[model samples]
Target: MEVSPIWSSIVTAAGGLLTGLAGTSGPLWHQRRALARARHAAEHDTTTGLPNRRALTAAVTRTVRRATPFGLVMLDLDGFKAINDTFGHEAGNDLLAEVGTRLAHLGPPVVMAARLSGDEFALLVAGGSDEIAAAAHAAWRAVSHPPVRLGEQAVPLRASVGHTTATLGISPRNLLHQADTAMYQAKQTGGGVHGATEPGPVTDPPPGTRRRDLRHPH
Candidate 1:
């Protein structure tokens, strides 16, 4: 069979064009996917798949800017150091991940759950005092119940939670500090939920008075 040179050239050029488009688009697609992954990793805690402190700060800032009524709950796991020391950091990490899962699923009136740092987390709640208090108590029960099993060990979890409703003129830092202060107070009183007494702007804890220093020994 004989084919026209011009027709064959047209077909060959079309094939090359399609091949070139694929070669160009494939890397572009992969580059876009990589960028998305980087952005997600930047905003998320790798261990628990929850929003990190940076993301939580951004959320608080946005909420405050919009003048939305909301609440912040700060929670710190009790005796976390003892868990790390006894069962190893792996077990501790596993427990933290489990806690994150529980908090993330707390449902309604609870807007977002974030991991602030090691063994510490925050919940962004929406509503008035009653709603906020309900969410805080629910979070405490969710974290403490049923126990998390790491290998052959069934580990019990306990946390001190401090929650505060946002005020008219509260900065993001002050709001977080207020919640943290309440959490510290809860820790001081043997670990339970505590509400912030100061609804106005608050100061950071004094030097050497960090909450980590107040962690109860197991």
Candidate 2:
């Protein structure tokens, strides 16, 4: 029997549609895979490639539940804002990236750095209070070593560190808060690093600004 022209046209259209879909399939699959990786990268630190705040918080919660002891260090770059203002943001970003690299080099129990935002960052060390302190000191030294080689004068940087530790006790959030307070105290006492559970108040006087009492601003 002879096929009608309408029937032949319908079959041809169906075949074309199927071929188009088949041609697009590979690209669609690739797009889906790329999106998944992007999502994972967003949840991690851009510089250190460590877990970002979201991931870190989840990990901290798990660590708390498991009663795993760890140390926390909240750090603030001393002259970061000024540095950025003077040189430019590119330089500033480079400095932060370098800091992240240094932290990654320290390894677990030694350092886990995350740029909380701008010149502010945090570190998680898997050890006791003493180890946390030592780590903080080492971090401070590393940061203050010399200016980064950004084709500019050596850009000297210093960090104020606050530290707290728990040997399978206390929530990670609370420990982080304690470290934050200590870091501020370091600022008040005039440059250098400080370690404590609670820092009195913001003591770091502004440049060319002096205070009589160690607690002068108080």
Candidate 3:
């Protein structure tokens, strides 16, 4: 069959153009995806898949710059070293992942959940003192109950939580320090929740206290 040279030329040109686009676009797409993955890895905890400390610091800085009232809660797992020693590092990793999942599900008021290092974690709550306190207690309940199951073993987790409310003009470092101090206070008296500005009493959850019966400050 005879074909027109003009139409044949147009068809050839179109095919070449389409092939060239695919060749370039494929690599460009892959490069973009790789960059996204790299960014995510940089900002996230490899063990628990939560935001790492660097990301948390950025969030705190942004919140402070906005002059908004918020709360920072720092929590350290009680006896995490023992867990790692007894169950092996794999189990410890599983437990940390479980805790991260629990905290992430705490929903609004808890703006962000981050894993700071080893068994330390932080929560950014969107409110003042009262809201922060409630969020802290809620976080305690989330990790404490429904023991994390690693293989055939059920591991009961306990955390010492300290939280502080922040307003305008507070440095992120100072805010984090306040929460860390409160967490240490809670840790000192076993494990429970404590507030930075509060004094005289700490809400200590008795060992083996049922989740429903655990009392927190009002």
- Output the number of the TM-score-best candidate: 1
Off by over 4 Å in 2: 1-32, 47-50, 167-169, 198-218
TM-score of each: 0.85, 0.72, 0.82
Please name the candidate that would achieve the greatest lDDT relative to the true structure. 1
On TM-score, the stronger of 2 and 3 is 3
Candidate 2 local lDDT, 95-164, one digit each (tens): 8888877765666576456766556667777777777788888777777776577664777778777677
Write model 1 residue lDDT over 103-205, tens digit each, in one string: 9999999999999989999999988778888888998899899888989989898989999999997888888878888898888789999998954444454
**Model 1 CA lDDT for position 60:** 90
**Tens digit per residue, CA lDDT, model 3, 91-192:** 889899999999999998999999998788999999889999999999999989988898998988899999999957889987887887788788877889
Predicted structure 1: lDDT = 0.88
Q: Tell me the whole-model lDDT of each prediction, alpha carbons only.
A: 0.88, 0.70, 0.87
Ranking by lDDT: 1, 3, 2
TM-score of 2: 0.72
List the RMSD of every prediction in angstroms. Answer: 3.7, 7.0, 8.3
How many pairs of residues collide in model 3? 0
